[model samples]
Target: MTTNLILTNSLDEIAEFVTLLVIFIIVIGITYFSIRIVGNIQKEKLGRGNIQILETQKVSNTKYIQIVRIGKKCFAIAICKDSISYLCEVDEGDLQFNTDSSISKSSAESFKTIIDKFKKDKPED
Candidate 1:
């Protein structure tokens, strides 16, 4: 009966090893899927970011001009490591930006009407 007991013990050990390996594989699969989900979430956010960079032009080495759209208006900004400055506000009629169909934008009004309103609202010096 000693040989019979030894055979039973070997089978039990093999079963335990198989169970542990299956558990390890499941853990690795869960980790990989979770990482993929997180990456997709971050990509979606950047794709629909509110502050859109329409164009950029690099001048010199570090100095660069960026045309950015903030809400309904667009502005040009000068970016550098030490300081950042707003150069001017670009009229929306001047440049057109290509956007994804997923993003919703408001209807555009006539540029002539916008200019007339700006001149009327200006305060005399």
Candidate 2:
């Protein structure tokens, strides 16, 4: 009878240990999934907070240019009679002037010179 009682007690202890382990695993899984969901939500919110500015104009008689500004970066998208060019991440300080006609070749050349000078002044990455 004493041996039977010991065996029964061992079985009960094992059952209790298994139950606790299952509960611990469920808790850890819940915590991990909750953290992942919250992280994704915050990332989406940050993405939506970004600022976008659009400017469109006719560069010349046959060419059109659209400028987009996101935060401190600027992009110039040009659509000629049959060709398209995308110039991205242009700094505002690199531009000679904030005028629509600044998209012209002469102004673009000046802007390129300014950017080159700025790059030369910065320390190497």
**For this target, which candidate reaches the highest TM-score against the unseen true structure?**
1
lDDT at 77 for candidate 1?
Answer: 97
Candidate 1 per-residue C-alpha lDDT over 83-104 given as tens digits, one digit per residue, 9 for 90 to 100: 8899999997987654543122
Ten residues in sequence with the least summed lDDT for candidate 2: 99-108
Candidate 1 stretches with Cα past 4 Å from truth are 1-36, 96-125
Model 2 local distance difference test score: 0.74
What lDDT is reached at residue 89 by model 2? 64
TM-scores for all candidates: the values are 0.46, 0.44
**71, model 2: CA deviation in Å?**
2.8
After superposition of all CA atoms, the RMSD between model 1 and the true structure is: 18.4
List the global CA lDDT of all models. 0.78, 0.74
lDDT of 2 by residue, 72-106 (tens): 67888888999989866677776554545444434
Residue 75 shift from truth in candidate 2, angstroms: 15
TM-score of 1: 0.46
Clashing pairs in 1: none
By lDDT, who's the top model here? 1
